[model samples]
Target: MVAVSQNKSIDGRLVAIGCNYEPWIALLEQSGWKTHCCYDLRTADSILEEYSPCICVVDLSNNDFSLNSISLRANKTKQVKWIAIIKKEQLKTDAIRQFINNFCVDYFTVPIPGSHLLDTIGHQLGMLDIEASSWVEITSQHDMGLFGESKSIKQLRDMVRRVAMTEVNVFLTGENGTGKELIAKSIHNLSKRKNAPFVLVNCSSLARDDEKLSLLDGTYRNEEGAPFDGTLMLDNVEELSKELQDNLLAYLQAPSCESLDEEMASDVRIVATSSADLDAAVANGDFSKELYYRLNVFHIKVPTLRERGSDIFLLAETFLTKFAREYSTMASTFSEDSKQLLLRYSWPGNVRELINQVKRAALLAEGNEVKAEHFDLPSKANLKQSLRNIKDEAEKDVLVAVLETHRGQVASAAKDLGVSRATMYRLLNKHNIVPDVRHYNNGYARE
Candidate 1:
C-alpha cells in the first residue's frame, strides 16, 4: 500500500507564467503535470494561492515583467519549483540570465527536442518527490552557476559524488574546452584521494612515438621509496599511440610488478579525458579496442556551453569576477546589449572561449562597463554562414535597445530584458557591449 501510494505521487502540478495554451502544455498535461497558465502578477499570485502548484514555468516570450515578481514570490514561498522556458538566443541577454540564477529551479531552451525535455522534466519531478520524502526537515538548495539544470548534468553530478567516494578509474568525454579536465579535478577534490598528488599528462602534446614508450619511466619513481596513491589524469587519451595504448594496458593488467611493494602500492586512481570519440576510433581500428573498454568503466560527458540553457551568464559572471580581480578592471556590469550577445553566441570553444574573451576585455576596456566595442568578435559578414548567426544579430539588436532603455544598472538592464542576472553577462559578450566601469564601492567612473 505504501509503495502504491508513493508511486502514484510522482504526478505534479505546474503553474505556468507568461504562457497561453501552447501545444507543449497539452503534452505536459498528458504526462501528469496539471498545467495552469498566468500572464501577470495578479493571475500568477491568484493561481499560486488557489492551486498551490509544486512547479512554476516562466515563459520568456512576452514576459519580462513577470520575472521580477515571480522571483520575489519564489523566494518568499521557498517550496515551489520554478522553471524557465527560453530560446537559445535569449541566453545572451543579461535580464534572462540574472532571473534564472536568482529564481529558476530549471530551464528548457530552444532546439531542446520534445522527448529530451519531457525526459528531463520527468526526472526533475521524480527527484523532487524523493526530496519531499525525508523525515528530517531540510531546505532544498539549488545552484544555477553551471549553466545546466538538465537531467544529464544532474545525473553526472550524482555519479561524480558516488565515484568520488571510491578509489577507481574515471573517464570523461566532451568537446574541446568543455571542461572535462575541470570535472576531473572536481572529482579528485571530492574524493578521499584529495591529499595525494594529482598529476596531469596531456597525451595529445606528446609525439606519437614518445607517447608509445613509458614517458614516466624516469620522471618519478624509477628507484624505490617513491610516493603513490596520487591521481593521474591522462588528458586527450584519444591521441595515445597504439603502442602506448597497449603498453598502458599491460601495466594496468599486471598488479604485481606494477604494485609499489603492495603496502605503498600504486594507489593512483586514474582519470582520463578525450575530446574525440574513443569508441569510434576503436571501431575504425585506429585505437586499441581493449583500451577503450578498460577506460569505459565510468564516464562523464560535459555538455557544451550552448546546451547549458540559461546558466551561460552564470559562467560568464564567474569569468568576469575572476578576470576583473586579476586585471584590476573597473567593469562592474554588462550593458543590456552585451547581455543579449552572450546568450546569442554558440560557444564552439565552450567555457575556454568565454574565459579568453573576458580576460581580453578586462585588459582593453576603457570604462567601468565593458562595451560591445571592447570585444573583437568575428565580423557580421564572417558570421553570416555560422549556426549562431541569427541568434547573434537578434541578441545585438535587443541588447542595444535595452541598454538605451536602462542606461545600465545591470540589475535594471536585466530586469528590462526579462532574463536572470547571470544571463545579462552573456548578452554583453554576445554583442560586445561593455558596462559602466566604476571602482568597487567608490561609486564613480574614472573618466
Candidate 2:
C-alpha cells in the first residue's frame, strides 16, 4: 500500500508505499515525518508529481507489489531517495538485489526498528537539502561565469556540477573561443579546493621543455612562494611536444612530485583543454595514447556559439551591456537590422569574437542604438567578384564553426552538416581552412 501522511507539522516531505503501511505510517507519524502515501502504483506518479518529496519509503512485503513498477516510479523521480522495506529472504533473489541496488538508497528487513529507519530517512533528507542549496548557489552566482539559457548550455552546467563534486583529472575539448578555461575555472570554483590556487599552464605558450616541466612538476612557485595546488589547467594540451608529453606522462604516473611534499601533491587536480582531436592525434601518433587516456578521465566538450543558436543574441546583448557600462557608451540596444545580422551571421570565433565585436560596436556607436553597420558583418555588394568572395567567406565561416563545434573531428563535422567526409575535406581544401587547429595557430587567418 502507498500512502501520503496528512500531517503538516513535520519539517520534511516523504512518500510511502507498500501493502502494510499501517504499521510504517504509525512509526513515521510517531517520528514526526510529513509523508504523502500512495497505495497503488497507478496513482504513485500523480503523488510524486504533486508533492516532489525528497525521500520515498517502499514496503516490499506485498506479494502483489511489482519491482518493475517501483523501478519505473523511482526512475521518474530521480531526485527522490528510496528506502526499501523487505523480508530478509527477499535478499536471496538476484532481481530484488538488483532492484534495490539500482533504485533504492537503503534497505531494511521486516523487523527494522523505528529509530533506525527514521535515522536513515533523516540522513537522506539532510543530504538532499545540502545538494539543493549548493545547486541554487551555483546557478544564481554565475557558477562558471558562463552565460546562456540554451538546452546545450543547461546540459553543460549540469555536467559541470557533477564534475565539480569529484577530484578527478578533466579533459575539456572545444573550439578556440568556446570558453574552455572559463569552464575550468568554474569547476575549480565549485570544487572542494576552491580556496586553493587555480594555476593555468598554457602548454602552447611555453617554448622550452624545462619551462613546461617546471610548471607541470610544481617546481614553479607562485608569488606567495607556494607550489601550484588546487587545480592545474593545462591549456591547449595537444600543443605540447612529444618530449613534453612524455615528461607529463611520467609526472602523472608518479604518486607525488619530488618537488612538492605529500600535502601539496594530494591537493592538486589536473584539468586540460584541447581544440584538436586528441583521439585522432593519438591515432596519428602525434599524441601519447597513455597521457590522452590519463587526462581524459572526465571529458567536457563545450558547445560552439552556433550550436547554442539563440544564445548568440543573449551573449551579444550581455557583451553590449557590459561594454556600454565599461566604455560609458550611449549604445543601449541593437537596431532591428543589427539583431537580425547577429542572428544570421556564423560566428567563427564563437563567444570571444562576439565579445570583441560587441565591445567595438559599443565604442563606435554615435547613437543609443547600434545599427547593422556598427557590426563588422559582411556587406551586400553588387560586384560579382566581391559577392562570390563574400559567399566563399560565409561558407568558410560556417565550415569553421561546424568543425570547431565537433572539436576538429572531420567525420563528426561532416555528419552534423549532412555532408560526406570527402566533400567536407574538399570544402576545407577549397576554403584553405585547416580543420581542428585553433585560429591563432594560423595567425588568426580570417582576421
Positional deviation of 429 in candidate 2, in angstroms? Answer: 13
Residue-level lDDT of model 1, residues 26-89, one tens digit each, is 5665665554344467766766655433566667755566566666776654235677778888
> Can you tell me which runs of candidate 2 are displaced by over 4 Å?
1-34, 37-113, 116-127, 141-145, 211-228, 255-264, 380-447
* Candidate 2 residue lDDT tens string, 317-420: 77888789989999999899898878877777888888889988999999899998887866443234555777998999888878767777778889999999
Cα lDDT listed for each candidate: 0.66, 0.78
* Residue 318, candidate 2: alpha-carbon lDDT: 75
Residue 60 of model 1, lDDT score: 74
Superposed Cα deviation of residue 73, candidate 1 (Å):
32
